[model samples]
Target: MTIAEDRAVELQEQIRLPRSMRLRLTRNGLTLVPITQAHWTTQRRIASQIEERLPGWTAVGEFSVIPPREGYSPEPDVSAVPSDQVLPDASKFQEDLLRFVVEVVSPESEERDYSTKSDHYALRGIEAYLVVNVLTARWTLLTRPQGGTYRHAVTGDFGEKIEIPVEDQTLVLDSSQFMRV
Candidate 1:
C-alpha cells in the first residue's frame, strides 16, 4: 500500500469519529468534518430527488468512495451508482462504481468542494461532479473528465435546471427549491 493509504488505515483505526462526522483523506492529510443540519437536509432532498427520477440508479447520502488514487477517500454528500452493480464490499463503494457525486458547499468546505474535489473526482474518472453552493444559490456541473480535469463545466443559479448525462440517459435536476435554511 502507498504511504497515504497506510496513513489512512492508521487514522481510521485510531480515531473514533462521531456518527455525524466523516473522515476524509485529502491531499494534505486526514480531516474530520461535521455534518451540519443544513448539509444533511439538503443532501437528503437531493438524494431523494435523484432516486425518484432515476429508477435504476441508487442514490445514497454521505458514503465513502474509495478511489484508486492514493491520499483521497472522499465521502460525497450524495453518490449515485447503478442499482444492479454488486458491491465487493458493503461498507465502501469503489470509485469505478460511482456514476455521479454531489458535494454541498459549506462555509468551511468551499475550497475543498470547488477546487480540491473537482480535480480529484475528475482524475478518478467520475463521470459527473456537481457542486451545489447554497451560500451563493448557484451550482456548477463538471463533466467530460479528461487529463485530470473536466473538459466542460456549466454553472447556473439555483432556480435553473442542471442536466447531467448518466449512462444512456440524462438526469434533469430541478434546483428551484435549493437554498440555505
Candidate 2:
C-alpha cells in the first residue's frame, strides 16, 4: 500500500466508529451517504414536524448525537460522537455514534440508506435507523439489530405515523404527509 493509504488507515483505527456508519478511506476523500435534493426536502419536513411537537426535546437539523469516546456527524443523514472527550475535536465518526439516523430515501440513495447503512448501524448498537422512502411514500423504521442486522422493521405508509424512542425516551415521527408520495 502507498504511504498515504497506510497513514489514512492508521487514522481510521485511532478514531472511534459509531454504529450507523463506517470511516472509510476512499479516492473521493470520504463518503458517508448518498444525499440528494429530494432527501433534503423530506428531511427538512421531518425536522419541521418535530419542531412543532415533542416537548423538552430538541429537534436539530444535521446536529451531533455524540456516541462513546468521540463525536462525528455523517453527511446529511446523522451525527453522533462520544462526549467524554468533548465535541468536534473528537472528530471522525462512523455509524455507531447516532441514537438515530434518518434518511429520506431517494432512488439514488435508497439502496445505500436502506441496506448498507442499516446493517452497519445495527452492528454498532445504534438504537434506531429510519428510512423515509420518497419513492414509495413509506417510512421504514428498523430496530432491534442482532447479529449485525435489524430483525424488526415496520413500514408506515404516507399519512401513517410511527413512534420512535431516543435515549430511552419515546417520540412520535409523523408520516402524515409522507404517505402522499
Clashing pairs in 1: none
Cα lDDT tens digits, model 1, 49-81, are 888888789887656677546556777888788
Top lDDT prediction, candidate number: 1
Q: lDDT tens string, model 2, 1-78? A: 556655765786687755444454444444454445556667777776655554544344453333421122234353
Query: Which residues of candidate 1, in runs, are more than 4 Å off?
Result: 1-5, 86-89
Candidate 2's displacement at residue 148, Å, is 1.2
Off by over 4 Å in 2: 1-37, 61-97, 179-181
**TM-score of every candidate:** 0.87, 0.63
Error of 1 at 159 (Å): 1.7
